[model samples]
Target: MHFPVSGVDVFPLIPPAVAFAVSSVTACAGTSGAFLLLPFMVSVLGFTSPAVSPTNFIYNIVAIPGGLARYIREGRMAWPLTWVIILGTLPGVFAGAWIRICYLSDLKAFKLFVGLVLLYLGIRLLYESAGRYLKTREQTIALEKKFQERMRKIKSKTSTHLAAGIPAEAVVKNRLVSLRKIEYDFWGETFSFNTITIFILALVVGLVGGIYGIGGGTIIAPFCVSILGLPVYTVAGAALAGTFLTSIAGVVFYVVLAFTPLGMHNAFSPDWFLGVLFGFGGFWGTYCGACMQKFLPERLIRGVLGILVTILAASYVIQFLII
Candidate 1:
């Protein structure tokens, strides 16, 4: 299939297939897989136009709801954090979109920026993952042992209650929401973060996400976990919700820009058909990933994401050097 806007020739099934595989894994970390998908579109599918950024945002628009729904259903959604992220990111997304359209249209420069951003994310996740294993070994071991014992007790109770057939309620509970801080309880512990700090971070992340077409969830999720000392389980929903909202703004911005003369110069309009195809696969993938996330170890998810992102970043940088 040939997409005239993107000037790429490939099988129609390819995009969704790749999207499904990527989304299923990345959704566990609160990302829509747009960071990885951007590279795939650029390098594998030859979609290097400026419009690719907005098109990727479209994928987030379509793909995120399924995962967000799961998170909300599980009562893991942090309403305060979601609102903060949305408020902070919306303005920055507009600014970032303008910058991308006006300044960073050059493919080489854009690729360099993307490579650097990915490098930063990769390193941060890896460093945090390493710290988890090294600095907190004893604590981690004790926590795991306790968790195992709890699981055993739950299983025994569940078996006994099987005849009653009552479903278990969500494990996450929102404790407090305020302008200065937000707090939530998950499992047996309470996690809190400064609202102002998150807002600031979301603003910066929105700017970067607008440029990269990732909707900011990828960066925000990791930051919430690694820096803010929040659990991945609690942060995932808010991060994805933020990404979805920002992506809607981004796509609208790109569409409006496409009507102007500037947009025509760099193909700022998304290839809607292609983006939707990718989203179709992402929908199911994201839903499944979110459903499975609670069963997986947080450290394992972070480690895998870190390694995968690092490899992709290295490849991009190496390609630039070779060129």
Candidate 2:
């Protein structure tokens, strides 16, 4: 089948099916799987053009909503964090998009650049996971084990107020939204974060996401847990929501760029058929992934994701040098 805009041939049920599989696994971990999709487009399907970036963003536009919706429904969504990230990232995305159009038209060069970026991001995740996360996880496990022993001894199982003397009603209150700091109660623990710091971080994440055709979730998720010391279970929803909104803006901007009278040789526009095919697959993939996330062990998830990122980053940098 022929796609009208980019003149790419479409394989009925094949691309979307593949997209669904990729998006499903990654989305659960707060990724749109665009990083994976971009390679698939270039190496596998041979959509080896700069247009692939926007096309991947198109996947974010369509495929991200399902996961975002799930986060919202669960009431785990963090609005302040999402807003800060959106505010900072929205502008950077435009700059990054422009860069893609103006300079990085050749797929080979673009791949090298992207590979390096992804490589850094992947390594950063590993560094944090190893340096800080392991200790934190051990502490939590020890606490939980002690708590379980206490519960088994007395059979007294009231809800644990991780924060001493905090009431059940207070936990329901999303009482953590500020420019200076954020303090919220979850699973009986009151957590706080620096709002200004997060805003600055979000902008950087947005810029990278925009250029890479990924939603900022990939960056924001690690930042929340590794840097801010927030629990992943708590921050996941907010990250997903923030990424979803930003991607919406990103895709619209990419589309608008295509329509605008840009002087670049390869102007920005999406391969609608390709994006839609990916989105259709991402729809189911996201749904299944979200469901699976709850059952999967936290460390296992982190390990797998970390490994994938490191491998990709190494491959990207190596390939760039070799070629």
Candidate 3:
């Protein structure tokens, strides 16, 4: 398939397959996988133009809805948090898009910026993981043992009675929502965060996400979990919702910009055909990943994501230095 806008020629199946693989893992952490996919488009697909950023955003527009629907259906959508994230990130995304088009069009500089952002996120996750391990190792072990026992009982109870494809019951309930704070309950535990703090973080994340075409969830979710001490289960849905909304705005912004003289000079229009191809796979991948997240251990998911981000960040930095 030749996508003239992206100046790439390859099998049509490649993008979707890669997107499916990436989104399956990333969606578990509330990311739409654009952070990883952007790199793939640039390095593997030869999409290095500024237009690539908006193209990546288009993937989020298509890929996020399925996962968002899953989260909402599962009663995991944190509405208050979602609104806060959306409001804060919306303006910043516009600013970031402008910056990307005007200043960061140079691929080298853009890659370096992405490398630094990834490095920061990876290190933050690892540090949080280590801190958690040190502070709560005994408690965590005890909790895991208890959880395993509960799961065993559940399995025994459902072995014959439940249908093979049916998911276990899990729900999120609101405990509180206020101007200063927000709280929710998932399973049995309550998770709380400062609303103001999250809004501030979202603003910064929006800027980075806009420039990177990731829609801020990739950054915000980890920050919520690691820095704000929020549970991943609750954070995942809210992050996805925020990402979805922001991505819609981003795509529209790019489309409008594409007609202007500035847009023509910098290839500001998105490669919609290529993006939709990636989105086709991402849609199913995100749906499956969101559904499976409840079955996986939080620690295991975070550890894997941290490691993957670290490796990708290192590779980007190394490539830049080599070049």
lDDT of each: 0.82, 0.69, 0.83
lDDT of 1 by residue, 1-323 (tens): 99987888889998888889999998888888999999999888889889899889889989889999999888878788889999989988988888887888877878888888899889877876785553554434443454556556767878642121111353567888888888876656677889899999889988988888888878888888777767676778889999999999999999998898886566888989899989988988899888878666667678899999999898888877778
Kindly list the per-residue Cα lDDT of model 2 for residues 1-323, writing each as its tens digit.
Answer: 77666666767788888888887777666777777878778767777766777788778777877776765655556667777777877887778777777777777788887788777667766665563565765533543344445444443455543221211232223676766888876655666788888888887878787777776667788777666666555566667666677777777887777776772445467787788888878877876766565444445556667778788878877887898
The total number of steric clashes, by the backbone 3 Å criterion, in model 3 comes to 0
lDDT per residue for candidate 3 within 19-55, as digits (tens), equals 9998998888888888999999999988999889889
Model 2 sits at a Cα RMSD from the real structure of 5.3
**Sort order, TM-score high to low:** 3, 1, 2
**Candidate 3 collision pairs:** none
Error of 3 at 147 (Å): 3.6
Q: What stretches of model 1 exceed 4 Å from their correct place? A: 131-147, 150-170
Q: What is the lDDT of residue 184 in candidate 2?
A: 74
Model 2's alpha-carbon lDDT is 0.69
Whichever of 2 and 3 has more lDDT, that candidate is 3
Worst 10 residues of 2 by lDDT: 163-172
Lowest lDDT sum, 10 consecutive residues, model 3, at 161-170
Q: What TM-score against the true fold does each predicted structure earn?
A: 0.91, 0.85, 0.92
